[model samples]
Target: MRPKQLNFPLNPDYGTGATIRRVSLRAQSHRVDAHLLDNFHEMRCSIVHDCSIVTAITGESVRIPTTACPAAVHQLQSLVGLPISTPIRDFYAGGIARHHCTHLLDLAVMAIGHAPRPSTEILYEAEVPDELELPVPMTIWRNGRLVCRWLVRQGAILEPLELRGRPLGTGFAAWASLVFEQDQLEAATILARTWLIAIGRRYRPSQAAGRPARDNPEMLGRCYAYSTGPVETAVMTGEKEAHLHRLQREA
Candidate 1:
């Protein structure tokens, strides 16, 4: 068997969540796919396509038939006028109608989340270092075109160094999660820790209320650096579970 694809989950520690999901879409296409697998529950499906559900067929544990309440999560048609990049905040503001289709909303969000990540130049520029000598950009590639890059200090405190040219996007962890269908429902236990290290905790350690990430190494070799990691990395795992459950309930 092939190695399991890496996906970051939003919550773990329960039979409800612990799933691995993947999302795929063609460029500039309306069609999208979401595939979800609950590893701990030993429930899995693949190569099953529902035009209604391009990715994984979700809510197996929830076990409500799609036909039972068609209106509950069928608001996707109203989303046509909206841009694919519509932020989740804006989507939430749209309000859920009693007949609104929650699965469609979830899948649509997953579709938009797969958006392309920004180049290293973009992330570097976003940091906007203080007056300094001309900075250089270093490029590394994987599989011929995948430039391998990461953020690290130049052996100094809070100093950001230049690295890769391609990343999924701002809040990439979230977007990548949607794109990859690795939300907390999939692979919860491992993904929780995986995200902690890969997303933020590994880079921005010891974050506290209001203190933020003041201990990370900076490009200046003196001051603390701005953190690019996701907020999920800072909070305890239980916090994420609570947050996700609230969102699910609201949906």
Candidate 2:
């Protein structure tokens, strides 16, 4: 049997009448599992009011106002937690809503360096699963070197990173907020390194042991640079860009 469809309000001000019907038209067409449809329907209902109705000629169409959508509100809330200066809040919000994950990371990097030209040099190697991985699991790399790694998993015993500093747990949330809110690569890199150092001091990992040589700050800036220095340089020098452009032309 086909599962019942759901609907949600377009504008909350319409009381109960402003909802738009959202049928499981796509799921029905695909023959997806009934349980999945039901779960989806339930989730939609919880997020907003559903209003599905039947019409004689058209059958059914969900009526929603299009003004009071949850998407805008959700996006607004996400931006609220960021530490952007008031003047650029809207700009950052729009960027976040429209950007892909990689682009967002790029923005963070640029923000850190206060670079005027947007940079897309940093590439994300993989998506690290937050819950399954270690609290302080490595999540980001620039070039071939590690830029940031997880240092503390939530719910784990708290460790002290510095001799007289607070527990590592105390700073995790703030650090995470700064990271996610970054609008440029340089900023993200700096934040990532800071997070790593905090983790290293707390956990005393061999990876975090030494300071970098003076000639190569990128190579030895921190543990991550040692592994990712060459990669970062290659990207910065336009070699990576040229190679990518060549591949695209060939394709």
The prediction achieving the highest lDDT against the true structure is: 1
lDDT (tens digit, per residue) of candidate 2 on 1-251: 00111121122221111111111111211111110011001111111101121111111111211111112223222322232232333443432423222122223322322222222333222112222333433333334344433344442322224312222233433444443454333333333333322211121112222222222333232221123332243211101100011011111
Tell me the lDDT of candidate 1: 0.27
RMSD of each: 17.3, 25.0
Residues 1-251, candidate 1, lDDT per residue (tens digit)? 11122123322222222122222232223343432222111111111222332333232222221122222222345554455455555554523422333333444454444433221110000111111233322222211232222232221112123312313222333443453433232222122222222222111111122322222223111101112222212222211111111111110
Question: Model 1, which residues run further than 4 Å from truth?
Answer: 1-31, 35-67, 97-99, 115-251
Segments of candidate 2 deviating more than 4 angstroms? 1-120, 130-136, 155-251
In model 1, which range of ten residues has the least summed lDDT? 119-128
Backbone collisions counted per model: 38, 30
Candidate 1: residue 139 lDDT (0-100): 22
